[model samples]
Target: MNMDNRRYNVNARSLPVSNALHGSSTVISELEPLHRRSDVVLNEQGLPRHSGCTRLKKLVHKSKIRFGTWNVGTLNCKSVEVVGVMIQRKINILCLQETKWRGEEAKDIQGFKLWYTGKVSARNGVGIIIDKEWKRNVVEVSRIGDRIIFLKMIIGRETVNIVSAYAPQVGIEASLKELFWEDLEGLIRHIPQNEKIFIGGDFNGHVGREAGQYARVHGGFGFGELNNEGQTLVDFSLAYDFKIANTCFKKRDEHLITYKSGASRSQIDFLLVRNTDRRLCKNCKVIPGDAVTTQHRVLVLDVCIMSKIQKRRQVVTPRIRWWQLKGEKQDIFKRNLLDKGIWESQGSANIIWEDMAKKIWEVAKVVLGESKGLVREIRSLGGGIIVYRTKSSIRRTVLKPYICVTMRKIGRGTVWLRKKLRELWVKLVLKLLKNFIRTLRRRKESKIFIRLPRVGKENQEI
Candidate 1:
């Protein structure tokens, strides 16, 4: 085999005097077919594993942040369950309206922290709930009456400002509506231009389906016709160059509607962000099967997070299988160290320790083998559907748009095939879920038994 031999050079000036104590004279050359570093990593089962910094860069450059907005009518007794719903949806930040939480201070609900603003009674109120992971980054909190509350957080290298608001109803006095807008205007003006901001709440308006001249703010995807309240929101968005996140994505009417009761359906709850950051949004749809039990459906916004400072992610070093070093391998390791001329060098105690450590690692790696990479299992669910499950990245369904279009063109045959494929996918997901639950239960039971003995004998049950 044609081989490419490589060698790493060590600095001579840094060498110490103690290296003469323990020594070797072997010259190590990495050969392509022998001891060369392979770009393709393999696991114990001989399967290929993903290596390098590509995955790490993807993880650090863009993070998925989910924002949910819902008008719970009142957060009086359902704070715990509502937080649970947020957790279930994997929401990082939640903005609530009509909370009826009569307080101007922040309160802890379960593990999340809630910052709310309201008057004396349970009337109009707005609140912002931050996930426990990001709560420590909070730098400032602003509570402005019962209609608006703003929070600023230092996330990574960027500053994020979140505002929760509850606008006056459609039939409310014109003066109150005007006052609401005026207050919101002041709040917007006070925010720094360099910081990222997101405002979410029950706006009680619809931007309509026609973009017309408002295409800068609305993406021509909306439910219901435009009303006076909606016109006000659109005008504000146009003036500030902010995009309505819900209107930016094209989804079915079911996903667009945020409030539904009997025959009445409307898109009122909204999430707004700067137009420049609109491209970072992946999906903004209403959660249909929300268990919050409220008139307003939960509007979830999936936005790709960006950090101003680029930090290098730490790579995990594989563990060396030292147990495999026996017989000929152990002799080879000793001989290679002796050949490296480690003892012949003149070095101090610290330098000797460093040289010996390096020589041992290199000799062992060459004598034995480099650590094996992780092997990931690929699952196939009949009908050409495949899924690659791994801890390095989220499990994504493998689908090609071109293939789907081609399948649809084959008439009824394609339709039948698609139906069968969907059925198989569902079944596979359910099976995986069952197995995951079983594993979790086993772990929980094991923990219980382990702690049971630690407790007093009188307190422990059989």
Candidate 2:
């Protein structure tokens, strides 16, 4: 609900880069690809390490990453100002869905690199735009079947994989619906485990909570289940760890509707971010730049600064140590060789050795009947085979400590599988249970038939 309604005097040439958070610069330096990994194909146009690139300047200088996602309802050749405003948001990225223009025609715009459709008059197509500096070294993967376009942009030093998607309005056609979700899943799977990603656009679905302040908002979390159109999108959002970017719909004074006359427009467009997505800066938003942009206003996002956070190191302490205790009362066999307390107190520059005794312990427990009882250190993490020799003959064995593993896996119940089996059994049992209701109904009908004056035994029986 705390939406900023501040207006900017934006000019095409000298468009002021807004810094929402800080006044000074703290942009992260352009990265040099790790030379150790030769598989990484270097970008020839990558800004030199010391060169102050414009994209990098905006990262720390500007507070918000301005972005807009709109349906652009008007015909291709119409609405110049609307298109300009969409680009003017200086949108770090723009997702324009249902644009009637083709990719070539869409590229004719003064600013913003366009990722558009092949034809000039497509009923539906999506486009992507990046700052001119970003356009030089940006790669894209468009999954046309799902109607989604993914862009890989190295804005300065950050490598962001942004996906712009448009889901088909819900319908009974299984082929279209299935292909949409399947292609999306495949795209997500291909994303590198470490790369940061943002998925945004006109999902045409509601993802609203039933109890939140914005509950009435245009089905925010894809109106969950109530409207089939909203359900698919919401479910996908949930399955993936995506946080809702546009949480607030209308600012305190702004009208409730964003699209229609007298119709409450509670925000439908979204700027979604993954939990692990790299953040350029904290202050970012989807602001309404111009009202005339075909109903859906321009989304203006700003990021004042970007910096890397140093990861904190955690120190782990073991539960027991042999040398820490005084005498034989300490049954622990393993020694704490690396403990700083022991070294500091004794002032001994000595290394405690486990192999000093030159004893080769067999994998089998001689006392136990089971030959597969492998002897291994508790903290050791690995798998291996262990063979043992008996009095009569040598026996082959598996190193898997089956008993210990099963014991450790105990408390965490298998309710996931258990619930599925339970529900299936419940359905079968419920099928048989319906017979009792049928019997009761039959008895009630017979009693009523006999109560009738003209009803006879034959009539009651029938």
Candidate 3:
């Protein structure tokens, strides 16, 4: 009776007061669950309605090409074996030094092709090996003696020059060393500025651990202390605006050192590219234990070519054949322009010029018509050879060895002529000998001075 009397007295004072008190308790109960929960939620109906922060996804299209260099000591018998290592590492182009393979020749081994140049004696030589995928793209191969060799190839609308160089040792003659550098510089100078150049070889120098004064070319992360040869290399890089690719990335002593023998270890080999193309080089490091040779380790460089995806639609504007506007077509075009009142247009000079141009284009389109475009057909001569026919003459580009001896013997007219003459002389001699033998066979006792072997048991007289 006492509790019921107190509740009835509180409610009798104000009905609204009791209702407000009940609503506050309900709100507290709802908030208590929200405070205990770990998940966060936004208001369903609000001014923003969504988050202010946004997530972005990036779309990047890039093609990667791997370049490597090694001093194989001698590549005569190990051609197939070294190619195996290249395939395993997925190297597209490789530079070899001290190949000791005499004569300039292009040999194919296990799908990989090697273009090498050396002297008569098997001593120092340089060569470039391209993978099967890129072998067909080679357009030109230039051999600068036995020390330097380079090739030009087309890779995705870009022209790339790959050079393989072998510098002389420290103990070599000073004059010869200078000559080598001079030849290298000359080679680089002749290449067009638009093309990409990658020089990978055993430079036989140490750029030091710090860039110091050579910071422009050296990347501050190098091996060993700087020497005279290293300074020469740094000077060359400065002159040509090149970056020592191997020194650009930070690496441990093991990966930084390229040549190791006994307790001696140093980074003598290097890969270089133009300063403008430095961004294309993603990584450069030495691969240990996978050595095809003993002293020098394999240096691999990762080059990335970023091709932007074009999103805009290409608008091919129709080109009117203005040359066709003659005789009746020319009169028709003039009449249409006059009928359009292009010359009588009134306003500013810009307005009159725009009207005139529009009228002329419209008249020309109706009178002359658009061109169908030029037709060009490219023919392949098989074996990496192509014949390009132009308005003047047909140009032949040889990328690899052709099956035909005459085609392969191009550029050596004297040698080819001599070979043909010798072949003809041999055929004539063989024909005369065949006739003499036939005469001897016809006469049973004609060969009394010399006895010929019996052709068969049925005709044993000869």
TM-score of each prediction: 0.56, 0.46, 0.57
Candidate 2: give its CA RMSD in angstroms: 32.5
Between the candidate structures 1 and 3, which one is better when assessed by TM-score?
A: 3
1 or 3, which is superior by lDDT?
3
Better of 2 and 3 by TM-score: 3
Candidate 1 C-alpha RMSD relative to the actual structure: 22.8
Per residue, candidate 3 scores C-alpha lDDT tens digits across 1-462 of 553243222211113225532443223334555334322122223222123311122234576999999999898778888998998888999999999988999998888899999995568999999998889999999999999999998876678999999999888999999999999999999999989999999988888999998889999999999999989999999999999999999999999999999999999999999999999999999999975688889999999976554443434344677767779878888888888887798899999899888888888888888754322221122212222323233333432222222222232446676567545533443353455556545654223121111111211222
RMSD of each: 22.8, 32.5, 31.4
Clashes of 3: 0
Winner by TM-score: 3
Q: How well does candidate 2 score on lDDT at residue 340?
A: 22
Q: For every model in order, what is the number of clashing pairs?
A: 22, 25, 0
Candidate 2 lDDT at 393 equals: 31
From the highest lDDT down, the ranking of the candidates is 3, 1, 2
Task: List, residue by residue over 194-232, the lDDT tens digit for candidate 2.
Answer: 666777677666655442433322223322223455556
Report lDDT (Cα) of residue 318, candidate 2.
Answer: 26
